[model samples]
Every structure is written in structure tokens, then in C-alpha cells.
Target: MLGYIARRLGAGIVLALLVTFITFALLSTSFHDVALTILGPAATPDVTADLIASRGWDRPLLVQYGDWLIHALQGDFGESVYTSLPVAASVLQRLVVTLSIIVPALLLTVVISTFLGVWSASRGGIVDRIAQGISLIGYVVPGLLLAIGLVVVLAVQLKWLPATGYTPFTEDPAAWARSITIPVIVLTIGGVANLAAQVRGRMIDELRRDYVRTLRTRGVSTGAIVIRHALRNAGGPALTVLSLEFIQMLGGALIIENVFALPGYGSFAFNASLQGDIPVIMGIAAFGVLLVTVVNLLTDLANGWLNPKARVH
Candidate 1:
């Protein structure tokens, strides 16, 4: 297990480095006139050239990347070209806000999907069909539309919760919950569809496996047979989908954050990209890539633990 974990961790770190390097190289090469973009077009050509030279924008891309990467390793991501704030500071602060909302949403997605999937799979026919139908709707609807509809009907019409904005949980717990509820709901809609459907299908497959039938013939109760014998192996593929959904929700968060006006990594990335703030853009991209890679590694570890057959392969 230790070796397995070490291997996963090593692979994740290597992948994260590669992602950051590739992102930095791509941004550097693809975009031109960074100094002018941030400095404004009205600036004179000499001023622009001076600004670019002063900022080392004229340096070879590799040297720039190397300096940035070294500084990043030492916990300095440099100052934001737009905000002039340390990139790491801004990213981390907003990252906390994002986690407060999205983390709960991810857990909720897992729990809700797991329950619905297991129940629906255990009982085929009407229950399965109903679960499938709901999953279909969730899978089909775009997150932006779902967020809008939820805001309109639930918050605007019913007034059950505040329609938009966020408050820190430390400031007021109730307000925090109220603030994140809509965003969480929006992310969960898609997450449930992604996770539950995969789990249900996987469960059905496991239930039909020869071992499951043998367990039943040994006089095990139906629930025990399904939960104890089938679910362990069945959960592996479901977990894969669940992890992917986590990453998907994070990506979709760009839309949801803007809609709700929550200050999060998504909004930061959006604004930074729009303003040509390369530092913040690079920071956001690296953070996201690392986050997804770590989660994928953890998912693999979980799958191996849940189904030991995974470890052998």
C-alpha cells in the first residue's frame, strides 16, 4: 500500500509539472504584445517596447519559464500583471471561497449519487427507470440554464433562499450555507447524472457476475449479497465517473461562479484571462491541473483499496 501510494504521488507530481510547463510555454508563444495588452493600446510604441524589455518579455520563453518555475517552487508565483497582488495570495484566497462551496457540492454529489445508484440498481424496473429518467434530464441540461432556472424558481419565485452572493462561514454560518446552496445545487445536478448513471450501470453488471450468483446460492440474504458481495467491486467504475465529475464541476464552476457572483478561482481565472493577466492565468491553470491530478491519483488509490483486483493490475 505504501509503495502504491508513493507511485501514485510521484506520477501526480510529474504530471503536474508537465501541465504547468506546457501551459506556460503555450501562453508565452500564443499571445503577443503582453506589455501593450496590460499597459493599454494608447501607450506609444517606444514605451511599449521599453515596458516589454523591462519586464523581460523579450527574454527567450524557456528562460522566462525557468525563472517562473523556480520562483513557483519556492512559493512565489510572482505579482499579478493586472492586480499587482502576489498571484499565489490572490489565487489561494479565492480558492478558499471556492472550496467552501464546491467541496460540499462534491460530497453531496457523491452521497446522493451513491444512494440513488445503489437503490435503483438493487431494485430494477420502475425504480431504475425513474432514476434513469432524472439522470437523463440532469445529463442533458446545460449548467448555465440549470443555474438560471434554479435561481428563478427556487430563489426568485419561492424566496426560500437568497438568490445570489456569498458570505464567509466564519462571518455567519447560516448566511454561508444560504449563499452556497444554489451553486451547490447547480453543480450537483450534473454530478448526479454523471455518477449515478455510471454506478447504476456498473452495479447491474456486477449483480449479473457469476460470483454474485454464487453468493446468493450460498444462502446469503439479497441485501447482503448486493451490498457486501456486489457493491465493493461495482463501486470501482462508479468511483472513476465520480472523480471525473469532480473535475467537471470545477470547470463548470466558471459559469456558475459568474452567475452567482461568488468570488472563486473560476471568476479569478475568467477576469484574469480577459484582462491578459498572464501571472494569474498561469497560477489558475497550474492550480487546476494539480488539483485534478491529485484527485485522480486519490481516486485510483480508492479504487485499488475497494477492489484489490485493481492493485494487481
Candidate 2:
């Protein structure tokens, strides 16, 4: 298991490097004047050139990329060309906000989806049909739309919670929950649907397996057969879908964040891109790539643990 973990970690690092290089190349090539864009067009050409040169924008692309890579490896992450704030500091602050919301949403999604999925799979009647319909609605709704509807109903119409902005949990626990609850629900909708579908499919497959039948024939209680026998086998593929959904949620929260005005990494990246902040944009891309790679590695380790046969292969 240790060896497997090490190998996956190594592979994740390689993938991160590749992602960094590609992001750097694309941003550098596409943007002709990063500093000028940040400075605005009204500035004199001489001033713009001087500003650009001061930031090493006059350097060769490869040289710039190399320097950026060094800074990134050293945890510097450079400064935002637009705001002049350290990229690492900004990202870290926003990450805290994002994680506070995302973590609870993830946990809720897993628990709710797993229960509904297992129950639906085992029953397969009107209850199963109702669960499927709900899942379909969740899966089809766009995140931004869901967030808007939630804000309208819960914040505007009902006046039960704040519509936007984050408060630290330390400052006021109730306000913190109020600020994030809607956004968390919006973000988890698709994840819950996807995970429920995957879990249901896997559970059905497991229920049909010979081992499950053998356990049933041995006079084991249905609950014991499901909890001890089927659930373990169903977990392997369900875990894969769950991990992928998590990574997708991490990378794809930009629209929801914008709609809700939450100050998260997604919002930061979106603003950076709009302002043509090349360094900040590249930094966000690098962080996203690293996150996805790490999630994938963890998924592999989880799969191996759940099914020892996978480890052998």
C-alpha cells in the first residue's frame, strides 16, 4: 500500500508539471501585453513599456516561465499583475472559504446519496421511481440556475439568510452557516445525483453477484447480506464516481460562485482572467491541476484498499 501510494504521488507530480507548462504556454502566447492590459490602454506607450519591462515581461517566454516555475516551487506564486497582492496569499485565503462550504456539501452529498441509492436499489418500486425522478431533476439543473433560485426563495422571498458574502466561523458560527448553506446546497445537487446514480448501479450489480446469492442462501439476514457482503463490493466503482464528482465540483464551481458572490478560488480565477492577470491566472490553473491530480491519486488508493484484487492488477 505504501509503495502504491508513493507511485501515485509521483505520477500526480508529473501531471501537475505538465499542466503547469501547458497553462503557461497558453496564457503567454494568447496575451500580447499582460501589464498593459492591467494598466489600461490610456497609459502612454513609454510608461506601458517601462511597466512591462519592470515585471520581466520583456524577457523571453521560456525565461519568464522558468522564473515563474521557480517562484511557484518556492511557494511564492508571484504577485497579481493587476492587484499587486501575492498570488499565494490570495489563493490561500480564498481556499479557506471554499473548503468550509465544499467539505460539508461533499459529506452531505455522500451520505444522502448513499442512503437513497441503497434504498432505491433494494426496493425498485414506486419509491425507486420517485428517487430516480428527483435525481434526474438534480442532474439536469445548472448550478448557476439552482443558486439563483435558492437565493430568490430563501434569501429574498423568505428573508431567512443572507444572500451573499462570507463570515468566518470564528466570528459568528450562525452567520457563517447562514452565508454558506445555500451555496453548499447548490454545489452539491449535481454531485448527489451523480453519486446516487453510480451507487444505485453498483448496488444492483453487486446484488446480482454469486457471492451475494451464496450469502443469502446461507440464512444471512438481508441487512447483513447488504451491509457486509454487497456494500463492500459496490464501493469500488461508487468511489470512482464520487472522486470524479468531487474533482469536477472543485474545478467547475466558477458559475455558482459568481452567481452567489462567494469569495472563493473560482471567483478569484474568474476575475483574474477577466482582468488579464496572467500570473494569477496561471497560478490558479496550476492549483486546479494539482488538486485534480491529488484527488485522482487518492481515488486510486481508495479503490485499491476497497478491492484487494485491484491492487494485484
Which candidate leads the pack in TM-score?
A: 1
Error of 2 at 56 (Å): 1.4
lDDT of 1 by residue, 288-309 (tens): 8878888898888899889888
Which segments of candidate 1 are over 4 A away from where they belong? 30-32
Per-residue alpha-carbon lDDT of candidate 2 for residues 216-284, written as tens digits (9 for 90 to 100): 888899888877768778888988888887877777767767777889988888888888888788788
- Candidate 1 is scored at a TM of 0.94
Best by the lDDT measure: 1
Q: By summed lDDT, which 10 consecutive residues of candidate 2 come out lowest?
A: 29-38
lDDT of each: 0.84, 0.82
Model 2 whole-model lDDT (C-alpha atoms): 0.82
Q: Cα miss at 35, model 1 (Å)? A: 1.3
Question: Each candidate's root-mean-square deviation in Å?
Answer: 1.7, 1.8
